[model samples]
Target chain A: MKKMLLFVVLSMTIFMAACGSNDAEGSSEATETEDGKQIVTFWHAMGGASQEALDKIVASYNESQDEVEVRAEFQGTYDEALTKFHSVAGTDSAPTMIQVFEIGTMSMVNSGHIEPIQKFIDEDGYDMGHLEENIVNYYKIDDQFYSMPFNSSTPVMFYNKDAFEEAGLDPENPPQTFEEVEAASKAIVESNPEMKGFALQAYGWLFEQLLANQGALLLNEDNGRSGVATEIGFTEEQGKSIFEWVERMNTDGTFANYGTNGDNMLAGFLAEDVSMFLQSSANSRDLIDNAPFEVGVAFLPHPENVEREGVVIGGASLWMSEGKEEAEQKAAWDFMKYLQSPEIQAQWHTDTGYFAINPAAYEEELAVEMHEENPQLKVTVEQLQATNPSYATQGAVMDMIPEERKIIETALESVFNGGDVDTTYQTAIEQLNAAIETANKARGE
Target chain B: MTNMTAVITQEDQALFVRTKRKQRYKQFIKGILFLLPSIALFSVFLFYPLLRTIYLSFFLTDASGATTVFVGWDNFVTLFQSTIFQQSIKSTFLFVLYTVPLTIVISLFLAIIANEKLKGIGFFRTIFSSTMGISVAAASVFWLYLFHPTIGFLNIIMDTFGLEKVGWLTDPSWALIAVAVTTIWMNIGFTFLILLGGLQSIDKYLYESADVDGAGYFYKLRRITIPMLSPTLFFVVTVTIINAFQTFGQVDILTQGGPQNATNLMVYSIYREAFTNYQFGSASAQAIILFIIILLMTIIQFKLGERKVHYQ
Candidate 1:
């Protein structure tokens, strides 16, 4: 009986420990070396080639400094990194400074756990004017700089020039309208029986880009720039046009559904399973190096009825923690300025396909040589410059945009699976409105 | 003389009752002493968090998981009406049905086959249980390559055979099956090991006695082998069911509950609600519902299935 009792106690303890850990707290002190230099932990979401480039930059920054050392920790994707930030926000476990995506701008501001970059800019007399105008427009809202813009990208359509020549279509001028893209897809299919013509990944970012290209807003109240958005902002025609375009290609037997996985879609294009896709220009370097065939980059397509607008900026920026040592914040500010220098920005722009936020980086030899070798790299910049400065092009600002994105992705997947477009669109609108209302209510206090 | 005798008997009865009460109180104190440590741990970890979840379910929460507004029963009511939540419930049940029985039967079959007195049987046993050591994340990522749409070997095989290529993880009907198949493959290793241990423990004397009585192999297996393994089977069934209901890792790594929410099991939905959407109130409500479900399932199994479980 005594042995049995001991066994029971052991098993109960094991079960108790199986339950998840409470967020650990109690340490609010910052770390300092014996040499009296502060350590600034910088969390980021850049992976692959960009990660390597960032590490090199940090190494250089540390080598050049003596008062503070910055540690760059690569957190997972943007969504995952943001989720982790929220769990440890306002605690000592949080990073001294972190990178946040463009869509998370509003949420990070509302989180009340970050010190606005405007404070440091004012004290340091930093000139935010040297950055690219289009990139600056997306980050600067309500006449204030909440974060320092780092990497920025826009959506552009990639086509197979070899496939175009084979299909008897013009290789120099790619399709610039949705109707022309549909026609091109049909022609490509006619020429190659084994390969599909087009693939639109069931991704939310591409869906948002398509809407912006049609000059449609994502939320009401001036895309939430003027005030908090209350409901859906785009009209029925603007939203349904995107659905109908995909449906037509799908009907023509020219559409390939890669369903929510971008890597798979990219792989399909490289394998010659699909001939065309719309992807971020951030992938330009990798795609050009990997594709076995000639690749061409063009502006994002719009519907034939509406005049062509431009794409929204898709990337991340750096923001400092709300309460940290003044010395640490100053060190981070210095690092941010270092990151925007011509040499570092040129290296970043060349290594990663994210266009340089610092325009002066374009004049650097590294950037100039990369553009000359891969001329397709210039198309993303041209597209960004062409965008009319409006609320729609500036992109929506909301705390619930991530939730809104999931809703849109689900609807797109349904349409790709042959569900009725009208029903899918209707369901998406209802869910999005409900999410916005709930978000507002959560912030009611 | 009669009254004097009656009073003496009543006094003796009163004395006996007093001693019995004292003995009962002493035993109760001893029992409490044995249970003190377990009770302390349970209160700190299990009971506190469970009660906290229940409290959070009745109020809305902000992004940092703080309670912002009070709305009684609203979270539960909204979950019931929400189509996405409804789809998640249906898919979870479907996934459980697809994975549980196949895992048990396949493992049991492997155990029986490897129980023979053949040469090098131990090698086969080790091979059968090899998947037990593979972590869930590694296993899911490996399966992801096999299910890749364009480059996966499975689709290539289908193409060679001239069959219509199936979207293993992209189609609504196939994504759950793909995940279920991956789960069954992962589970067979541990389940096979347990069942094989039970098989090895069964007494050989009974089989010899059956052979002396001219019993056939099928008859002996039907009559003797099954009844002896009942306890082990009962345990494996309960654990597998609970594990199936709590599946989150493979789904997160493989699908993230995509392809029109066809693979959005309850746990993944709760994760998305709480972490990604930052809707803690509704997430807590879902967690509570999942807990009640697993609780009722275990209770029902013990009540109905325990009778047939034979123990030595």
Candidate 2:
């Protein structure tokens, strides 16, 4: 019995030792050679096709310069990457640079752990004239860029051309306003009783975009840019109209409620269960490739009475971490600058359907070829260019944006379930404001 | 001569006492040495985190998990007052109610059927036990495909039966039931295996005696099988209840506590608080409350169930 006990104890110790060996090794120290070359780590949330493009760009940059050897790592999705960044912010394991999504911009700015890209731009006397004005406006705070916009996209309407033709609607003339969308949807439903006219995931981003298209603020204090917003502005007339329209659509059987799953909604559209849908421009490639019928692309519909304002960007940006060695920071900036170059941006745009942040990328041969092959790719650029840069169009900046988005999503779900719109929005707004206040208190802001 | 004998007896007694104490000391050292690793591991992974969670529940924390200020009982107070948290508790209990009894009934039925002496019983047993081999994530994904509203197998079957297609995931009324169905399916393999073991271990004599008396199958089952299986049923019930309370993956993957928070289980609420909202203090408080609730539930189950378990 004693021998058996001894053996069991030894085996357990060995098992624990084996388990201990699997922990990740500590971060490597940043070292600079006499030639001014430094090693930097760049963490990003790009995955799948986007990840391939990011890898290619990183590889090319590594081959192009001897000054910086960037080791790019894919760190899951944007939320996951930000969570990891928060966990390791003060630790040595924190990446020298990280990509943060648009919603996380406020959090990153308030984090105080980042070196603003504006500082590097000013130090290098780099001209920002080539960058798209509207895209750059998103990451800018108080006329200074907090991070560099990498891949930017705006929401647009995608329709099935075959469905439109079959429904006897003009394929070339898609719905340009909410009223027109309703009319066209009615016609489609009457003609084809089997298919729904439209479908969209109950995503908060779409609601935000719709509000922006109507030139309305989603949060107070000029969309939380001039001051910290204490309340949501989504209880305004435009917000109510948007909700009423969705509720009406659902009631009329003109809208397919796909819940909040974007992929499932996309599948519904691709399978032609719905004639039209609204999704990010980044899905252009997928629709063009995988869609069974010709995919028609158009600007997102606005309310008939309200003039259309341009949509806010939905992708993420690259932010450099603070407290790193100056050489490493500079190396990270060089990679960011490399990413924004016209050739690389064009390739990125072509590879992933994300709109290139550099307007000059449109002039690149690859981008021109891509547009020639599929003109829908050019519509996103035109739509962005037409956007009037204003506080509302810049999108909301709030530390509690994620929570607020969740609240809006919940409100939408409730409204869909025949809940009173005014009551739902009021309750949601109150809850959101309370949450914001609590977060501010927690942060001691 | 008497004094010499007394001194000899005292010396012998002293020797015996010393040897007994030495043996006990050796045994104590050996036992402690054997348990040291487990104690260390438990302290590091379990006990320390539990203590820290309790400590954190009283303080407000920043996004990076740094404590900013001491809030005393504010976190717990806010959680108790929040309607969402209350709804989550109700939803969790509803899920437990939906899954536990159904899982017990279905698995018990299968176990009895598979317990019969029939040809290819092993194949049928393997078929019923296959889900245990599937991971929660894989199973949830499979269920997601099967539960898709428009192009799913379930809806297709409903269509074939001339039934209206119910939005299994989208509809608020059906979402929780859909998730419960997936969970019940996932749990049956485990519960079935345990019950089958219990079924097989019953002495053949009792059933043989019942057969000689011309007792019906139902009579024999009620009199012999159920009583004999009571202990195993008790264990399965306890385990299933605990597992049901901690259901997170299916709700997260399927509904994300949505369709108006109809499926927001308590554990999912804790996850959202800590990870999504970065409210560690509130999350820790919720976790402690959940721990208490589970503890109370298990205690009640044991109290009510142990007496009914026939150990013979």
Candidate 3:
């Protein structure tokens, strides 16, 4: 009897331990109102100053309203946050809103977990002209706004003014064309024996930017949207030209490839070891504060043969979570509008070095005043204004784009790591097309 | 009257036995009461999830997490046919190959050194064991930064020595080796402790007998030390192989299976498919294969161990 009792106690202890873990896993799924306020939670990956800015916005909204209170929560890195958001979405305890990266836009749009913000816009009668056309159109799915643009940034050239002067190059006038950039960088390298000529983001964003400027479409059939058949069109003549340029740069050691991890680029740039970098304009504020030397910001260099179109937005947007009540949706709508107000837009842009998507915000006297005080903000605006309605050339969109991106990135890595560019790119094109086909099928395209 | 009294006494004895049985039954019921919570937990958590994964493996789940078709073995067939999946398997085996032997050998060496009656042995043991407390993700991140080709600490040190920068994690050729080195470093302690325990368990008489036989150090090591350490070595190798095959954190955090999929392990591929691509069915099929591989490897290890281990 005592032995049986002991076995029972042991089993019970194991059961309780198991139960404890389950409770931890399942506890966050609870959906209950706190303090009689219809509390809605939001999960986001934005950290540092960007996150702090978002939190302040949320706090302001909470203080302004008594009915619907949004509880903002940080969920870690972008990928981790997206994973957790997807996991908890359908449960009774899912967040009412989530900040999803641009790569996840298509998936979220198709998942039906996100409510169309266009409905809120119509109901609230918000001015359509308040939003920048390119920005609004980018987030739309079949003429419905599925998300709100929050942190839109474009890639631009960041030069160290001190490095430029040290190399006896004009510190004020940065390179305006690819040919000039190459020549100037080579000169800089020769002039200063210690520093590197150029380095870009590890993912080949610089290459893409160059291609975009040269009227090269990354994907066929209007970038795989609008019911057009798709193709991996980046391996065409235009792409080859860019690839050849990279090869020449690498071979000549004019441009040193950073580490496979992006740290090499970031660390080199921050330490003033590299003369020029092609990084997101969102890094403007951080660069200014952290850079050891005076920084010079400029528009991304265009190819001499073609007009400079513009850069694709690099950051995330606020997506409205699905399965929420009308009241919660209304609250979200109000918060989004509050975020898009001229004052908030100006502040966000000033603080984070992100471009304000609201034209009204840009035209605001306060924004102009701020831009006058710091001319670096004008560079991103100028870049955005230079953009054309070339959707195919702008940015490619696809279902399961992140997967296709991984394949292409792998191909890039191979080529950059001394593998044959043509063969590797050809292989990547084939693999990417297969992934695209599968994704399109999944999307019921 | 005398017969009736004898029958009554028997009946009383039977009644007493029945009362004792009831008391025992009550105790048994009390035991079951204690077990009820645990049984409820196991049924709800482990059993339910295992059954659910099996069920979900046969279905095509949509982005909305809705399942559609009952395509039994279709996912597995597709997985087997894909060159990428096959390559992942090959790479996973390679990772295990590099990590398992190196980790076991290194750890055993450390264990022997630690077992020696040398000064500061306790400090070395503590330092080695302390690494197990560090999170794999954190350690991988640190290693990734250290292996960075341009700004990495390794590169800086190499530059100081006038040596060219080595692509520790970037170059395809050296990526797996770099990851293996990191894994071996991180995991050596646990294996060391296990081997140390086995070493301590050896009968001192055997070594004394070897001394009597005038056996040299190498002879004693080959015959007594290794032979006696077989049981622990077998256990460590089996567990190490299992872990090496399941390597994902290092690849994911350090290299992200990059420089052209040089470090793409099976588990990482499975995770990418399941979580990133949301290909739950295919990922499950991969996981099922992994389970089988591990099971077979462990069984083979045990079989081999039975022959090699010197029980005496």
Candidate 4:
């Protein structure tokens, strides 16, 4: 009886602990209210040192305004933030501002959950010339802006200098073309049998980049817009080249298939065992700080057969929720304009190694003066400017992109696991088109 | 007659005092009513959400949050049509099929060895049960690093001995088996303890009687030990099957149901549908299917227990 009683007590304690509220714990004290001050909640998903820089900027913004207060909250990862936002947006109380990813912008805009930023710009009479040309264009739906562009980044090649020198290759001159990259990878493996030659995000993000460089359209008819209902053609002739390369790497033991986590490539690169890895430009700050050996940045490799095309932007943007009161809407506008300010944009770029969408900030006298000392800040801009603009290579706006990505990742997995690359790619195209159709129908697009 | 009446009155007075003491004990318990607030909290926080989920399985949500059209059987119909959903259900059942029997047989074997009256018996018990302390997420992460094809420790050992590295998590054929191996390593300890306890609880007199009847070790184990341990074995089998069906944490952490959906169990697919794709309606229907499976399994267990289990 005593043992049973003890067991019951222990089980109850465990259950209560699981049920206990260890919630947000209220970190900030209530600010002293003054006349005309409105507190605006802003939920974002940035963390680590990047979050610290954001917090400092928010503090400065609050100090600058006696009429508005912006309180930035750190929500969990990107997916969690979206889930939380949906849950809270229906209530009487919801955040006035949110940091949504670029992929989510089209869905949110179509859902009518957010207001058009073009309306805010016209109402407030903000100077259009103050923003960058490409930056302002990034938030367009039918050529009308809906969100304020914030953090912008593109993919680039990051390589280990030590590994290059060890393989009898020039560290200063990284691979500039696809053929050179393949050759370098083979050389690196032979030089060091213990090390892997190449690694990439298991998802088809890398494959998309390869297709873009080849100047091929992945999906037809403007990639699933109402005017153009083109089926997926990534399994066609040009796409076969990429799959063939994947197979060659897998069978030759040069390419290591990391499970479908982005961290796999980052971990392998940081360990200095992989000679070359492809990742986002936003990792520049982290790589500079944490890499044991010297790291170099270069433009994404292009094929020798054709000219390179523009790669789509992969970072996030800010969206303002609809159904907010006039006061809250005005507060959201103020915060949006504040983020797009030249000074803040430049600071954001320098702090996090993400690209500043305001191209003027890159060449303005003060910015130019600052850049003369640090030339590495110019790589993303150079990479972006040297490409031809085409819709097939432009940013994709497909509904159910997440599901599409799952199909691509599965295809890549099959290719890396010694399956027939042609069959896998064909199967992926068929699967993804079906998903796109389903999502488009559900969304009433 | 007067003396007898006086004695009866005294005895009645004593009985009245004992009854009064019992009433005081009841009042003492009532005085501890401050704990009602906590009980109310648990009922609201934990039990309420569970009941709400079961209730919510009947509804549906569209892409936009504003529209919640409750089509009772539509979601289930769509879910049943999905090839991926069907595959996940099949995979989950296969996981249970592979894990439960293997776990029971291995644990029972280990328990029998540990239950032997020998030197260092306590050490063996502690060593066998230590794996219960590792969380599923932590163990999956460790296994991921261990099985990484190129830079992993396992591959390094394989290279040393001139063996080709196996694609443990990447190959579709091997991914589910890899996950099962990690789960088996982590959970076998807890099942071992239950079986060991059951083994110890058997009355020694039966074994002594069997020995006097000239029974060998295997015969004693079969006739004397197996029947007596049937109840505990039944409980372990039911719990193991339920746990194997709900194997989400490892799949989420280690594989994410990739390599062409080889490791995609129903729970992980449900999570992807709900959280990743925001298809809450379909996800809820998948969850309902999982609930029905578990309910049927439980009923089957109970029915089987009534027939096969012997009390003595």
Candidate 5:
């Protein structure tokens, strides 16, 4: 009898241990509101200062009204957040709103699980005229917004003004063209033997931007708007030119290849190992804060012969999940609307280096003052405005963009390793097209 | 009277049999109850996920992990045909080859040195075992700093020696070696601790006998120590091979299987395929393939290696 009792106790202990983990699942589910206010959950990928900005925005929105309480949770990095969203999708426990990166836009659209922001806008008769066209164009498919643009950024040239001055190059006049950059880099390398003249992350985003600036589409069928991109549109000439430039710069001992890691390139710039680099304007604030010397910002350089059209946007946007309760959806939309307000956006832009999606945000007194004090922030806005809105500049909208970017990065690595540029680019395009085809077929598009 | 006595003894025998049966049943129940927790945990965590992975390998899934279409063996066929997958397999083998033996030899050497009764032996043992506490992510980040081409301490030493600065993590030729070095460094602590324990447990009389026989240090190390240490070495080799086959964190953090997929090990590829590309089916198929390969290798290791391991 005693042995049986001990057995039961052991079994009970095991069961209890198993049940312990389920406790965490309790807080994960959307809680029933005790008060009259609707509680809306938000899952975001922002971290550090960006997360702080998000919390501040949420706090302000909560304080402004008692109808809704926004509970913002940091899910992790963009990839991790998307993974979490996908894991919880189609389940009752999914958050009311989720932030997805630019690359995930098409995937979210195709999943048919999103409550398109256009529906809320149409029902509420909200005006989107204040939103920047270039930024809005990215999220719009079939001339309708699927997700609300939250944090947007465009790529530009970042240079060390102190390094430039020390290299006997004009700090105010940063390189605007590839030939000019090459010449200046040569001068910098010669004048300051310790400094590398130029460096760029071996990343596909910069390559895509460079293609966009050349008035070229990265994919076919009007960057996959008219129809799914059946093939990559980066022609051999365009691809080779970009590859050969990197090769030549490397050979000239003027350009440092940071090997596909963005952090390494950022570190090189901060340490003054490189005089200039091409990085996202969103990192402008970080660069400014970390660099010991004065940093110079300029528009990304184009080829000497190619006209500089503009760069595409990089960053994430806010998306609403489907099958959520009406009140939660309404609360989410209200929170999104609050986020898009001029004052809030201006504050976000000043706090984080992300560009304000609403053009009117620049008119905010704080934004204007902040830009005056740090004119480097203004360069990104000018660069965005300078872009001629077109199918090419709108960037690719393929579902396999992340994989495509990785392929291009690998191809770039091969070229840097002295592989033939033409063959490498061709092979990369072929592989990318195969991947896109697979994705399209899987989606039954 | 004797017949009546016999009848009583038979009844007693039957009663004794019944009581023993009841006790055996109770013990059986208790044993099962004790094992139920582990069984349940294993089924939920290990067996179910493994079976699910195999099942999912046959279907192409979308970004949300919902099945879109049945791809059959297409994922496997495609993976087998792809050059990148082929390169990843090659790289994984290269990594195992570079790390496993070197880890064993170096750790064994450290263990032998540490086994000696010397001054500050405890301090040396602590210093050797300290790396075991570091998480892979932390260690990889530290290695990244040390490998930074321009301002890294390694480069500082290279500059002092008038040697050219090598892009340890950037250059494709060196990236794999750099990651292997990091893995070896991180693994040495655990391997050293195991081997140290093994060395301490070795009979002192064997060495004393060898000393009386006029066996030199190297001769005794070869004849006495190695044969005695085979069991520990076998365990270390098996664990190291399995661990090396499953390497992901260092490759992910330090090299990201890049500079031309030089460090693209199997696990990292699986992660990239599933998480980055959202190709769950392909990732699963790749995972199953990795599982089979690791299983076969481990089986071969046990079959061939166990015979050589001396059991005193």
Candidate 6:
């Protein structure tokens, strides 16, 4: 009986400890610190090389100002950071600001969790005109700015110039169409049967980019800009083309099946196991620096018949939480404006391969020198500028996009591993529609 | 005189009944006092959340987990209809089948070997039980590197042996097995340690009597070691089954329920639905079902397994 009593007391302590209020311990960290400076907590999801560059930038911002000290925290990946944000929103532990991916725009708005940046812009009389138009277009909904565009990128084809030459193809001009890419893949395989021709990382973002390149919308309601999206807007022809392209590559044994792992696809590229892949332009710096062979960056490919309409903007934007103190908001606002300055944007553009939202940063000495040294980075910017502003190219905005991406990712994987393209594509669409409806019902729509 | 005597006896009976009732009430209050803290803790952490989960199952929740609308049994109906959830259920059972038996058999084998009275046997015991010290996240990360599609140790070995490279994490056919292998390796340490402890606690005289009867080593092991170890084996099996059913870390780190949702275990599915999809209603429904299944499994195990367990 005594042992049982002791056990009960011990377990009670453990349970109470587990259920203790977390905000009390967590909230005290980011509110303020020594020296009477309001600390603006900024939660971001930039990992790896980008985290290093971002930390340097945040540190410089702190040194530049005396009143507001900006604290930047790396909060895992985009999905993980968003989940954490939702759990902590409306709590004392919530950050003063957060960097959310482009797809999270609608969800963030509907969540009623964020203070739109437009109010801050208008109050400060800030200039939104100087920012990149295509990047801004994705974030601007209902003629209002929900988030300040920070780091932006687009899909670009990465090819091995050495392999292209080995295949007796033009090293300077990479393949510009699916048919041409298939032919090139065959040539590269003929040159050396061991090296695979292409690797598409069963990723959904690249699929969206390809769909937009063919001028197809991914969601209804004009890519969910007019109102809530109801279903997939892409026609069978538009969606099936991508699946068929992957299937053809699979049949030819030229597609390296990396299956939704970007890291492996990248390693395959660096190891010269696969010749070409489509990834975010944000990877350009890492690829150029690490690859043993010369890396060629090209515009995203469309089908043989459709005109190339360009790619959607990828990457995250700065969103201020709704209920932060006025002082913290001002501090975060200052940092946001500081980030868009030519000098900082130039540094960010060179350090990471993301676009400088301030197009004037292109003329900054740092950016100019980097662009001259590696013109592949300039191709990324050119693709963004070349993009025709349309519902398709502006990208889809839906809370369900993250879920939808998984559905499409699974379909892509099935095709990569010899699943029939037509049936797989059909099932994917049905699943996507069902998921959207479920999301809508959850929202009480 | 007679009336006075009768009244006094009735009064004594009344006093006796009143005292008995008062004593019983005081004891009940004392018992409740002793149990108060435990009751409060259980209600706060376990019971409240369980009730809330059941309540939330009958409604639709938004991103903030507020119930936006009452959906009745729609969430559960949809879950049963979802092929993804169906696959998740099948994969979870398959995962259990793969990991639990293998973990027990391998750990039992290692325990018996390490139980030998030999030189430097402590080193072998430590090595066999080393994985208990490693957290699931760390172990999964380590195995993720080993099973990486590119720059993986396993693939490197395959390449060296002049064999075809396998997509250990990427292929649907291999991903569940890969995760199971990691789980088995991580679980071996605890199971082996417990079984080893049980083996050591067995009476030396049992083996001595067997030896006097000219019993062989294997015979002594079968009769003495296994039967004596049955109670510990039962406990180990129960815990391992529960742990296997609740596996989330390995699948999250290694696969994220990809390669056609092949590794989407039940807990991971609940997580994806609630946290990822922000459908707390559906997630809660899944959770309630999981709770029922585990409850039934444990009860069934106790009923049947306890009969065979030889507790000494």
**DockQ list for all candidates:** 0.54, 0.49, 0.36, 0.28, 0.53, 0.48
- Per-residue lDDT tens digits of candidate 4, residues A132-187? 45455455657777778788877888888888899999988998876777788888
**Which residue ranges in model 4 land beyond 4 Å of their true spot?**
A1-39, A47-73, A92-94, A224-230, A233-235, A324-329, A363-377, B1-61, B65-83, B109-135, B192-221, B288-292, B295-306
What overall lDDT, based on C-alpha atoms, would model 5 receive against the true structure? 0.89
Candidate models: Cα lDDT each: 0.90, 0.87, 0.76, 0.76, 0.89, 0.91
Q: Give the residue spans of candidate 5 off by over 4 A.
A: A1-39, A62-69, B1-40, B212-214
TM-score of each candidate? Answer: 0.95, 0.90, 0.87, 0.80, 0.91, 0.94
Candidate 1 chain B weakest ten by summed lDDT: B29-38
The segments of candidate 6 whose C-alpha lies over 4 angstroms from its true place after superposition are: A1-30, B1-27
Pairs with backbone N, CA or C atoms under 3 Å apart (clashes), candidate 5: none
lDDT of 3 by residue, A1-445 (tens): 6797787779778867887988787765534465677767788887877788778878887898787688889998777788787777766567778888877787677676778777777877877676877776677667777788877888888888998887888989998876787877788788876677776544644565666777676677766555544666554676666555556566656675663566567677887667887877887887777889888899887767777777766678888877777677677777777788887888788877888987677777778887887788779888888877676444666556677667766776666676787887677777777766655554443
TM-score of chain A as modeled in candidate 5 = 0.92
Model 1, runs deviating above 4 Å = A1-30, A34-36, B1-16
lDDT of 6 by residue, A152-252 (tens): 98889999999999989999989999999999999999998879999898888999999999999999999988888899999999999999998998899
Comparing 5 and 6 on TM-score, the stronger one = 6
Model 2: interface root-mean-square deviation in Å: 3.0
lDDT of 4 at A170: 96
Report the lDDT tens digits of candidate 1 across residue range A147-199.
Answer: 99988889899998999999999988999899999999999999998788889
Q: Can you write out model 1's per-residue Cα lDDT over B1-312, one digit (the tens) per residue?
A: 999989998998898788888888877866886787777778888999999999999988888889999999999999999999999999999999999999999999999999998999999999999999999999999998899887888999999999988888888889999999999999999999999999899999999999999999889878988889889989999999999999999999888899999999999999999988989999999999999999999999999989999998
TM-score of chain B of 1: 0.96
lDDT of 5 by residue, A1-445 (tens): 6876787778778787768867666546645467877888899998876788889989999999989999999998787898788888867778899999988899888878889999999999999888998887888889889999999988889998987887788899999998888898999899888889888787888999998898888888998889878888777777677888888887898988778878878888888889988988878887887889999999989888988898888888999999988988999999999999999999999887889999899999989999988999999999999998988888889778888888988998887777777788778877988898888877754
lDDT of 4 by residue, B1-312 (tens): 999999999999899999999888866655544465577677788778657655555555444533355556766877777667787888888888888889999999999999999998999999998888888888899998887766789878998999988778888888898889888888898999999999999999999999899999999889888899998998898899999989999998888998778899988998887766766767767887898899998998898765798876
Which has the greatest DockQ?
A: 1
